[model samples]
Target: MSLTAAADPMLPEPFGILRKRRELSDTFTLELEPLGGHRKFAFRPGQFNMLYVFGVGEIPISISGDPDDDGPLVHTIRAVGTVSDALRTMEPGGAVGVRGPFGSAWPVESAEGRDVVLVTGGVGLAPMRPVIYHVLTNRQRYGKVVILYGARTPEDVLFRKQLEQWRSRFDLFVDVSVDRATGRWRGRVGVVTKLIERAGFDPHDAVAFVCGPEVMMRFSVQALNERGVADERIYLSMERNMKCAVGFCGHCQFGGQFVCKDGPVFRFDAIRDIFSVWEV
Candidate 1:
């Protein structure tokens, strides 16, 4: 509950949209700078913030910017509801409020010296983007880096340019797949889990991070397990109903754990008991 930097967790600090880029038809990325001469916002990778759009409402969004970068705070948001829609349409120079950086973080430092495999789908990649940046910036810290991504279609891919750039890097392994193909599309056509079988990594010594729909995550976990990755070495980012990022509200409760406070990122084995429970 006391994980945020705000003096009062309930109050939000002012921030202005420095720039906005549309990633997809319904999703957009916002680059926000502190307003009123405030200090730069810092947050660990995988942590999220409560974004407040005045006269509308607030919603929790994961931090997508690089943790080591001293620049605007970035959030890739999908316009699913009223608040998020407002945020997506707001132009540059528009004002918004920020309240968090709540929840757990990916074990980037611990993965050093071991292979790192990232499995994500659709917008889920936003939460994992920070981790990718961290690994690439400190390339020598880890043994191998592999990224497996999936989308509904070729056009649904997020960060297309960045993914291409990462794919070109000799030190990193990037593979993309889609459920269906479209015009001029020529790449793997299947779920992301298929790539795990051919991916070159020491499954016994590698750590996997997965973020996506619950069904996709469940399947990805199974695939990783079949590949010999231990349950303890696998992590999942859980995005549930998150109101009141400080945990005052019980919206994000998953069994006995509060995802807003205890997680958002949790080791697979830690929640294995309830991960498959219906409506959990």
Candidate 2:
């Protein structure tokens, strides 16, 4: 569905750019404040926004800040291409366009009172970060909160400080892994699935939200199913070449679904049969 013009005003206000150029490993965080105000933008834990850099183009990015905080909006952007590279060059007080609070969000309410496992790889943490924050802030509402994250290497792990804090709070459990470890690394030295195997959560009472590369999500769902989580209970975020965040461009089309509007987040059962086909 296209975002309505009426909805435009409610979109997260374009506040002045906060920290326009801070590097987090190879990626960067472009902090922004609402225009003329310091009031926080209202966004659900797993929603995303389309950020437009003047003359550089736009891309769909997950909102990574706490849903409870009404402060400036923060986005964790990886430097992968031209648009992202340009975003990295933006200085504080520069102007950038934004639209949304878009797409589906993790079912935080439905996961209440149940164990929630978040499996993420690489920048996949961006989308899952809010869910993690929600569960931590309202710890009493959920059962066990487990986070399993894997990166290419030690340098690729995102939100190191936040992950450290989450490690200390609530009934939090975190296992970080890397495909290959450097000399300084002291964590698991394999795929994230290996860590999941070690955590040994009871799948019967748990729900999982997984986001990462398609291959990683596929393997993660397989691992969860092997551990007894039902296909219907496992959720995944599917990535595609999304152009129009409103789902008009058809670039992110997968079979009959639009990854931008219909998903980005989807239940396994809804797309299980289609996933193996590779074309979608």
Candidate 3:
């Protein structure tokens, strides 16, 4: 199907501000309900929404709650710029516009019955959070679930409660590391690539999804390939300067693909060549 044909009907609605606003560290999680109706925003894991803040601006943020949370839609956003800073100031029960459950979702269905490894860094974890939730909630449908996460330091880690819960689950495996130690912190301290060396997996039977800074994705891909994972079995989420979520804007184009339309998620082999071209 054509990309524009995939537009979601739930996109253009004025969602109600259900919980006003709450802080999750330096980021804000806005809980919203349908403004004038009872219909819920339906979406798959890994899909993002274009959240509009009136005069401020709109930004693409991943749907951070469970896909089946029919109650309200949740968006976790960090205050990084003017628009985001404005969003941070929105009171609970205020108004905000949303346009999507846009772009492609992760290949969760294809991952059934296979060993799935999820590797993430920093805020990159936001996009992949739903995928992890999908896998954990439907644990019997997959094989071993391993999550390797890294961040700048302990203070920068997102979803600490969720991460701790994953670590405690006997059915799943969670490993975390940081680039530098902060004296009081006691855990794996090194580059995210360092933890990969000890990530036990039979690459031949595994499907890996990685997201983070471009440099980190490159190194993660190299590590996965070295361990014998097929390029097609490794996936990466791309982050670009996107304007229109629709394909008309060329802001997020990479080679022949539009990151907004074709993917924020792509198979390793599909973008392997362009990834190294410096500029695409």
Candidate 4:
């Protein structure tokens, strides 16, 4: 086996960028393949990896590629900080270091036979893409599949082409809205939570996955609760400030849980008490 396969989980394996696509002005999607031909980075939907950019720094980014695809690992990132900015400017052949596929995943398998509702905003859609891919692949195993996405404006919409393709499918329901309309945009204008009421899924029989800014998630949870989805059936991705992919670093600690190890993806009921608390 390759050293990467046998190495410590904390050791970042070398990888080379295979392709990079500009999704928005500040956001880019990178496709990475292991160097020295290590095994493909296998991970379930919603897991994140710590990406190290040589002398720059490291950041946790969600794996956006389909788990079933025999393709390179993918991460959709926005240039919000130094390390990510360096990654944004990198070319296809640029090198990077990856240390995980870590954290708990969305409970896609457990949600089988129930309606699946995905609510995400801005760049947050990246982590939810894999779940969409899984649902589409095993379409018959689930009931209604609803996707509700919101962006700041039309230009801020990530994965427009992919969203259009998903919308084209008769088996799924995709609705996108913007906080404001620019140019000739004629889509719905509102926060993502507003779309929850009109979504096709039966709230009581649904499993909802939410991600985005914490504020958005808070409101989304409120809306889901009002719509009758149980807290146990609602999940959230708290992808924030994780300096280390392993539990050794306490940067991602929230309440009694460490997001890097115990979560990043958590059931709402499990953290409901602290979920609404400010600056935990």
Q: Per-residue lDDT tens digits of candidate 4, residues 1-280? A: 4565565677788899999999999999999999988466789999999999999999999999999988899999999999999999899988999988899999999999999999999999999999999999999999999999999999999999999999999999999999999999988999999999888889889999999999999999999999999999999999658887788778888999999888999999999999878889
TM-score of each: 0.97, 0.93, 0.92, 0.97
User: What are the Cα lDDT values of the candidates?
Assistant: 0.93, 0.82, 0.84, 0.93
- On the 0 to 100 scale, the lDDT of residue 202 in model 3 is 71
Ranking, lDDT, top scorer first: 1, 4, 3, 2
Worst 10 residues of 1 by lDDT: 1-10
Model 2 compared with the native: what TM-score?
0.93
Any idea how many clashes model 4 has?
0
**Candidate 3 Cα outliers beyond 4 Å, as residue runs:** 1-11, 20-25
Candidate 3: tens digits of C-alpha lDDT, residues 27-136: 76788877887677898877888888887788888888788667788888888888788888888778888888788888999999999999899888888888987887
Considering lDDT, which of the candidate structures 1 and 3 is the better prediction for this target? 1
Q: Which pairs clash (backbone N, Cα, C closer than 3 Å) in model 4?
A: none
lDDT of 1: 0.93
Model 1 segments more than 4 A misplaced: 1-7
- lDDT (Cα, 0-100) at 81 in candidate 2: 80
